[model samples]
Target: MAVSAEDFDHRCEPCLVIDQQIEAHGFCVDCQEYLCKNCFSYHQRIKATKHHHLVNKDNMAKHAVIKESDECTEKCQVHKKEVIKFFCPKHEALGCKDCIVLDHRACDIDYIPDKCTGIGDSAEFREVLRELDQKVNEVEDIIKLAACRENELDSCHDRLIKEITMFRKEINDRLDQLQKQIQTDVDRKKFTDKQAVKNVVETCTNISSDIKQRQSRLQDYKASQQNGQLYIILKQAKSKLKSEEIKEADRSLEKTNMQYTFEQNQDLEDMLSRQNAFGKLALSSSL
Candidate 1:
């Protein structure tokens, strides 16, 4: 079988304990040795050596340089005696002649280096790099916008707190004014009621003094045995007792107890409970 250039590119380093014809499937960094698949599997399965790190043969191509000056000696993994000679583009794989005949007979095949040549200068390659740069810029913009939004969120929070505090203070100040007005009304009513009671007491005191004076005069009149004077004094006392001022004062003092009560405004309480002053925050649909 004719060995392809891809074989040279993927050629594994020679195993220490095996013939050069056997290709390595893995490389152990600790032991610094190339291993066939069977040996690599055995090394990992062993409890004593399982912890050691290993790199796959395919991945080692980038780090390991296979010189073109050296003879092609690496064998295929499937056909152990045959070397890889062609790359299948449809399958995106490297294979020996037997592998191509068995699994990729209908697939388009090409020389690896020839297919890959001038790829760096291709428009598709440049477009890919351009898209990557654009994606990076977009990510950067997103990060910057997010950072700005974070600051805005903090600022908005502080502003809302300040507004709420000011609003609360205004409510408190209004409440204080309301309290003072209610207190003033209470004081005014108290003064008016007290003055009414004072006036009633003064009128009753005057009536009591007049009745005592009339009683004294009648006693003197009776002692002198003057029936006319006694009759006149009794008549005057009866007339004074029936006076309008005395009758009105009696009725005024009967209903003199001033009563008052305070109750909370349900509408105001409901509004406070529902709205709570500090509004709600919501995400925009655009975001």
Candidate 2:
């Protein structure tokens, strides 16, 4: 019966390309290919691939993935066309043939395949893989924390804006109320001052009219040549003009200096000039 490909989990990459359907026992690290028992023995025996590093199938459970195309794709940075074949342990660097000859000639370099022999099964390699996994988990946690912080920041920003807007509205409303009150006070003061001035003017006009009437009366008496009547009229006019009521009116007019003026609230002005007039924003490092 023909063997179905489903029977093997890790099929030999070299055999899979040729439709051989062979099971792989080992994975070649340098060549990036899987080999059967016979192929693995042959690979080691071959002079070209004698120093090639390989990993057992069981050891490569997490390392190897079977593919149809299998070949070393790593190329040198300096020599683009040449594949990397040597490793410098001192610098932990990889280079091609010309690169090794020119730069790493003084250093004791090793064949990449030989240097990587049984690397997958090494304690250091396993520890490094575990460390990488831990580091990745840490990065994911940090990212999650950053996302939460970003969301919190957005919320805080919105809340603060609303508070500021509401506070400003409140301040404006209070200012409006204060303005109305001050306007009412100003109007009352103006009315009171104007009424006082009008009273003074009325009093002065009445006194002047009375004096004029008295003078006209005296003129008539003089024209009649009536000495007694003229003398009596003159005496009455003099006494009335020098009365206490007239003297009080003159004193009131002199004392009354009605001038409207406004003084700003210094406390309010100082509060506005301060940096944290509305409120202060406090920040803490601890979450």
Candidate 3:
């Protein structure tokens, strides 16, 4: 655990430790040695130490803390610096003054990123988006793969159905001849034949049910894809609206518009009449 200055205070040289009067800065840069302004040299020269270094100045304190500087969380692949707090009004990222001087000259620097990102840039929000987008993409890709599966099922089922129909027709013609040869009083032992017919009907029904289920899932997958797109837009909108300062800033931001107008309702009528327009569907009995 890191001890406070008070906990370590006067433990060494009492005279070396300065109060607020001298403006005490913490720790050294070149060396990890801790000292107030006065005792640093004496602390350095004590043993095998020939040259002692110290950090007392404001600039030195700032430099020493670089390793201790809190990591920046905001990501803009274009910018290397962590988004500290200040957002560049004209640019697309949050940055510091050093960034402002170089790349963000046209931007209005707002509050530090640390203070404003409590809700939007939190770990929970990031994790949620990452998981949601990943799952949505994965499901959509599976649905596309299912198209090939559906085609295979259709081809396999059609061939088997044709074969079944031909076999049944031959079996029925043989049964008719067998019945004519038998005596009228004969109690035909047809338990096996009845069972075979029942089995065939069941097999066909089961396959038809499988096809229906796949069709339903394909429809649901498409619906989910559409919903996923809208959900993404809504999430972005919610995040934008959540930050008060961002919303306020954007309200006044100038927007450039490009406009074109249609002459009549002809386009709307054409869309309504077109069978495939906007994914309108008409299904056949075979389907």
Candidate 4:
């Protein structure tokens, strides 16, 4: 009969140390080493390693291939010579039998491999991934909202500048109108004063001409011995010289003097000063 690959026994790893070619009959799960029948008997008989878990070679071949270092062959940190095979759920720790009996006596305990069965496909793993995705979406939403707020701030700033420019133009326009109105009033007053002064000069010239004519008439009368006409002329001249019309005209001119000035508006000044802080930004805690 031809030998089959499946029926062929693997060489024992420990037997190779003595250059012996013993066939492996089992695998030590804790020690992660192949064992022959003789070595398996010796492994079971040992006091320290007697409780170490073992699996038949046929059963071990059906499981996933495991690296020796990645296996449960790790020695317990507290119990140096013991392998860690049990997990304590209550304390959330892994340890050897001695460590579990000493520190986690009353804790819920189980084999580490048994608890790890189908963990990758478990619902809790999916739920954790879902929660992480939700957190990422929330962070993205916050970033989008912040970008919108930045745009709003920029728009508000531009609008404020536009409003300021508009108000400034309005103020300048109003000031121009007021200045024009004041100039118009000044021009009218000037024209009226000039006309009044011209009238005064015309009246004075007419009075002087009348006085000269009366003096000439008096001389003619004196030459002809007309004393009565000369006396009448002197009485008219005295009344005309005592009139108060010229004094009244000088007082009216003095009253036409106008003074223009601007008064400050404290409220408007305060409002303008506060323009330094046009807008304020605040964050919402709801995020």
Give each model a TM-score: 0.52, 0.59, 0.23, 0.45
Candidate 3 off by > 4 Å: 1-61, 64-146, 183-287
Q: Which stretches of candidate 2 lie over 4 Å from their true place?
A: 1-71, 78-82, 97-108, 115-136, 173-185, 222-229, 244-251, 254-259, 266-271, 274-280
Q: Which whole-number lDDT from 0 to 100 does residue 170 have in model 4? A: 86
Pick by lDDT: 2 or 3, better one: 2
Q: Write the per-residue lDDT of candidate 1 for residues 54-94, one digit (tens) a residue.
A: 88977654444333533235578999997765678788788
Residue-wise lDDT of candidate 4 within 3-86, one digit each (tens)? 543565676755643445677888887766678889988999999779988777787565335554344688989889978878
- Which regions in candidate 4 have their CA more than 4 angstroms from the true location? 1-50, 53-125, 178-183, 212-239, 242-287
For each candidate, the alpha-carbon lDDT, in order, equals 0.73, 0.80, 0.53, 0.74
> Which 10 successive residues of model 2 have the least lDDT summed?
63-72
lDDT by residue for model 3 over 1-287, one digit each (tens)? 86565654222222321122222444444444345555565556667543645555445545544333334456544455534435665666655444555675555555442234354768878999999999999999999989977997799779767877887788679867866655332323244444545655565566567556655655675677866755655555456446554333333232212233335357767876897653423444553
Count clashing residue pairs in model 4. 0
- In model 2, the clashing pairs are none
Q: Please, what are the lDDT tens digits per residue for candidate 2 over residues 1-287?
A: 87677988777754543346788999887776778888888899989998988788897576655442323469888989978767788888888767767777778877654446667789989999999999999999999999999999999889989998999999999999999999999999777767777888899889889889999999999999998999999999989867776677767675657566888999999999999988988887854
Of 1 and 4, the candidate ahead on lDDT is: 4
